[model samples]
Target: MTTSRTYEDLVKEAVDASVDGWDFSWFEGRATEERPPWGYARSMAERLAVASAALDVQTGGGEVLASAPSLPPLTAATEGWPPNVAKATALLHPRGAVVVASPEDASLPFAEGAFDLVTSRHPVRTYWPEIARVLRPGGTYFSQQVGPASAVEVVEYFLGPQPPEVRDARDPERARARAEEAGLEVTGLQEARLRMEFHDIGAVVHFLRKVIWMVPDFTVDRYEPQLRSLHARIESEGPFVAYSTRFLIEARKPGR
Candidate 1:
């Protein structure tokens, strides 16, 4: 006799099937790679070590924790993440890292004055306020984010055949204002633009879907019509360049 499966089991199977079909990299070989390094991981770890007491906000994939396991003990939390991610993170940080499944815009699980250094990369915009709220006075907050420039290929592939209005590091004033509003004094900012190469447009599309974390609102399904037009355009225009903009900004909370 066959046993009946629960609704949860069916949903889990569906989700797992989708994930398995996608050729996504879990970065299992992170420990072996030599060149380029994980810049965001190493850099954020360094800044946190400087602050003494630190928190890694939304520690997805645990790469940052893996990068700096020897640094000062760190508290790790990932807003609205699954237990699997938390479990993986624990492998790198056994003692202090704890996962929180709450949305990043809402109140965090940790108490006030919980940390002196807060490091985040590629977190949703709503999480910034919560990040500001959790750091100790006179603390440092460092975030390396994939800026609007990251959507270049997607915009070109889809989005009505025209480029989206994306401003680069030239918009320093706006960047400073944003950090200040988060209750942090802006210190330094840098934008590193890199051209990601793809063998063909199909490869570009695959990378966008799997590795890039394209905004949920602008998924491949939503942009399929435009993507077809984009594919045609690329066939006519030849190889294309995907521009990725990496922004590194450091800020400090005011001391009493």
Candidate 2:
């Protein structure tokens, strides 16, 4: 059986990997913060208030359902987020929240035209059509996502060499087009670029350990020696430069 580390150990190990004591206040502080522009929640509630049903697409930790008041019998469908939804269901006591953890790419549990509105946060590209399929015509689809430039290339550069393809959400325009193809009207779209600062290379490493949202299959094990070697080089060469990221995307489905 696989063993799990204590929360304290987990944190410490993550820090040790980074080696450099860095300021991580931003990530640490917002560790539990929901994605911004809560317009999607408001829109979901508004639409569900009118329609009979709604779905929280790939509900993570059930944060959206918990925060939105009196949502119309919010039903959640997670393609592969079993543990997440299980924990989320405990916190967000919607009237009915079903968990369907499917390994195969498929539509959420509901039938076609099942919900009048659908919402997702940082949804993978593979699921876009599924989101459109399950929503009723005139139903809105809302989502927020990490952009392509979301710390992947930089992290790879620092870590040395690259692993297999990491799963990613499509760029905003492509996602919007997919929504349109699915027969939903695109209404709202926004992007925000934030330059997150890391104090030093160690801070970057700590960020990776603690908050690395990269794919689950991603591993630094094979490259650990190289990373250590690079660290030594940086130490000898002088201060390592720090950088940040570009704007990620957000979009909304318009009501009929």
Best by TM-score: 1
lDDT of 1 by residue, 92-138 (tens): 44655665556656677777777888777666553556667787888
Off by over 4 Å in 2: 1-11, 15-26, 29-51, 94-96, 159-169, 199-220, 225-256
Report the C-alpha lDDT of model 2 over 1-256, residue by residue, as the tens digit: 1123333343345555532211234445222222344455576566556656667655656665556666665565564555564666666554566655654366466678777767665554446667667777666666666654565544665544454434234366766677677656677667654445332344335556544454333345544564555455444574334332222333344445
Q: List the residue pairs that clash in candidate 1.
A: none
lDDT against true structure, model 2: 0.53
Q: Candidate 1: list runs displaced more than 4 Å.
A: 1-38, 83-87, 93-95, 161-172, 211-239
Residue pairs clashing in model 2 are 20-202
Model 1 is weakest, by summed lDDT over 10 consecutive residues, at 27-36
89: Cα error in model 1, Å: 3.8
Q: After TM-score superposition, what is the CA distance of residue 141 in candidate 2 from its true location, in Å?
A: 0.3
lDDT of 1 at 135: 78
User: Relative to the true structure, how large is the alpha-carbon lDDT of every model?
Assistant: 0.57, 0.53
Question: How well does each candidate superpose onto the true structure, as a TM-score?
Answer: 0.69, 0.65
Candidate 2 residue 94 Cα shift, in angstroms, is 5.8
